[model samples]
Target: MNIYKQIKSEILNASHIVITSHKSPDGDSVGSSLGLQRFIEKLGKSAVICHPDIAPEFLFWLDTSQILLMTDQPQEVTAAFQKTDLIFCLDYNGTDRIGPDMQALLESATCKKIMIDHHLNPQDFPNLAVSDTSASSTAQLIVELIEQSGHENLLDEHIGTPLYLGILTDTGSFRFPSVLPRTHELLAKLLAAGVKHHLVHEVLNDNNTASRLRLQGYAMSQKLVIMEDYHVSIISLSKEELEQYDYQKGDTDGLANQALSIKGMKAAIVFTERDGMMKISFRSKGEENPVNVLAAEHFDGGGHANAAGGMSKLSVADTLDKIIDLVPKYFPAQ
Candidate 1:
């Protein structure tokens, strides 16, 4: 039998299952977890979503009442991990993405593990790894799993909504080059299954809070710095500035993308001082302007060519200086 069939068999045999995703949950992480959970439920079995942290407030509209968050309910998450017979890891390549606490539990767990991810360089951790770096999103992989495992008939609005959300956000609403023809085909299937695509769009894009808007506006007006020589833009915000605006987790989510929208900009970097470190986000336009290498080599982070993340222990001012100094080396002036 093929791997998909084997995965289905594993799900069927397990009595208890848990679904997990990376820390600092985003659309793809939340969407894939919920999508997979709903899919598993359609199989006459059930699973629990155990994430390292809560998703940003904007995603609260989804039915996430059942998720076990390590930050809020560590004991419950721990109990779930200890009792689960099967684990589904989604949207992340390695265990480290789930943070140190969950990493410890995941590393120590003896249960069977399966991974479905779209990122590069998947770790050798899962019993079955279904990683396709070229795929648009892990949510797309979940859709594929449903069709390939012969469970396509079980798909419904509950499952398709989250899956559609995962693909839409991860692809930047189909603007990213990672999208393929088959992606649209799968989307059509989801639409046929009664996924309210317009509602998903409204819920994600139209639900911004006043504080979020103000925070984004402040970042754009005050913190944005453009490196004309290297065609890169950088935005840095201190913790105090964030607090002044009542900053929330997802407030700065779109700053990097907005900076990259400049006419001559090849890349954008946004870093916020929080949690005793500088949390960085990278966004780029073309293959020639890949930012993952810069992130990996300089900031201990890596992701897709156009988008990545990293961190720095340096002070905010020093981090900005470091980035400006390093921009020329990676993204030469155009």
Candidate 2:
């Protein structure tokens, strides 16, 4: 399939273009959208990158401050959606991933929609879809698309930096199981394209404030709970605790990973009290123990098998209790 060729043609034919991704925009979501935006701009077509929510603090250095934020500048972003001739949905499965408010605007859009995502079971909503679940991240797919589209020359530091950051972050700096041989090949190509790889890594991983570090340390020392029989470890933080530590949006980003690293641990969970809900993040060792199913069934959230997320309207304590009751049932003895 001439996938990139078709997408390039579609972009060229459109006058005004808009790009978007899921809510709580992660590295992959924000990176691929901005990378694609830069590539398209170099082709003499300017595209506005719109996101349903804000990117985490760690990703702020990506300099996407100029991008239209749906939260802060709703009218501008809404107008962009209305007037756009084409919209590229990057890193997420559907309009649902964009959240309810943005989903309404997206569904109302009469423009051609292109879905470029790496999530499983994408919804059939886009006019053109290049969904590949096996791919590590949407950033990887964007690289393949540009190369296959015969526009590899357009991938300079501007495009490569964000793309590389997405792959690095989404794959846990190439430590996750999703990092395949193809991922390395893409990294090599990106490096050759002059992406500041080490600098990007330093910026992504090392740019943490003292408060964020203290918050992480507190969560690890005071809040962790381990279930020996179920091989699960959980950490729950109340809003009071978050406020005590001056919590920010990205503060708990990798807290679940610390729990998952314990000996004999197969499942790790983090629940943070946020806006009258307990926001949950789940991670497991392998797909053999799919967490998304457990999340969807119990927590009203879902994602990849090994890395899923959910939410609970219950108070933080009750939410933690409910999860403890469930861990034994779903994650039975191996």
Candidate 3:
């Protein structure tokens, strides 16, 4: 059977379902999982949403209070995994991205597995997978799945809110190039369903605390370093600097994009030190510049053409040097 049919069949057959996403869940991941969970509950099945940990506070506005935040292998999630008849992995494409614990459960579970995602290069694990890289967000794909599964009439505020958050955050509030006509149509549907648009906006964009604002200022002033060629920009923040500025986990949400705004910059990189290793985020301007390829090839990460991320064992300085060396290969004229 085709992917859509397979997904519909799985939803129909599932009596007990577990929904999960990758570690350090983003808006798309959390939003997709919650949206799918609510949809499944509407079918009168028992569904549980589980993630590695609590999502960022800003995302709390999406009604994630009931989500199971598992730091380790808890009895609840383990029992759910054992008993679940169906498992839905949303947003993430790879098991490694989901971290080892959940990956193990997914690999060992007797339940049928379905992957609903929009990310490029998905892992081959699911019994049924619905992957559309063209879709703006996994939540959007879930919306399509609901429609295909004859659950459109069941969509309510609980489901629509998270779906709206997923599309909004993934498309950068519909400003990114990924936003298409269908995306807008979905947004219109979500709005008509009474999803609180202004509240989502306020929670996502307006919840920046005073400390986060100060941290952004410090990062912009002290950490942002532009190359003389103007082809690349790098921003590095140490754990010390973050503490000094009272930075929170979600404080640096858009800092990488800020580098891209600089005139003449072709590529931008953000390097942050967390738990001794360097976390790097990459962004590029045009189709010819494949930041994701660079991330996969050079830094052990992969994502879309315009955005990517990876982690390195190297210190921040070494990672920056390594990334700088790679700049000439992509932008040779510089």
**Descending-lDDT candidate ranking:** 1, 2, 3
TM-score per candidate, chains pooled: 0.99, 0.98, 0.95
Candidate 2: lDDT of 169?
A: 75
- Model 3: which ten-residue window has the lowest total lDDT? 1-10
Q: Which stretches of candidate 3 lie over 4 Å from their true place?
A: 228-230
Model 1: per-residue Cα lDDT over 226-329, one tens digit each: 99888999999999999999998888888999999988999999999989999999999998999999999999999999999999999999999999999999
lDDT of 1 at 68: 93
List per-prediction Cα lDDT, in the order shown. 0.93, 0.89, 0.83
Clashes of 3: 0
Model 1 TM-score on a 0 to 1 scale: 0.99
Model 3, residue 151: distance off in Å is 2.3
| Number of the top TM-score candidate | 1
lDDT of each residue in 135-249, candidate 2, tens digit only = 8899999999888999898879989999998898788788878889998998898999999898997887788889999999999999999998889999999999999999989
Better of 2 and 3 by TM-score: 2
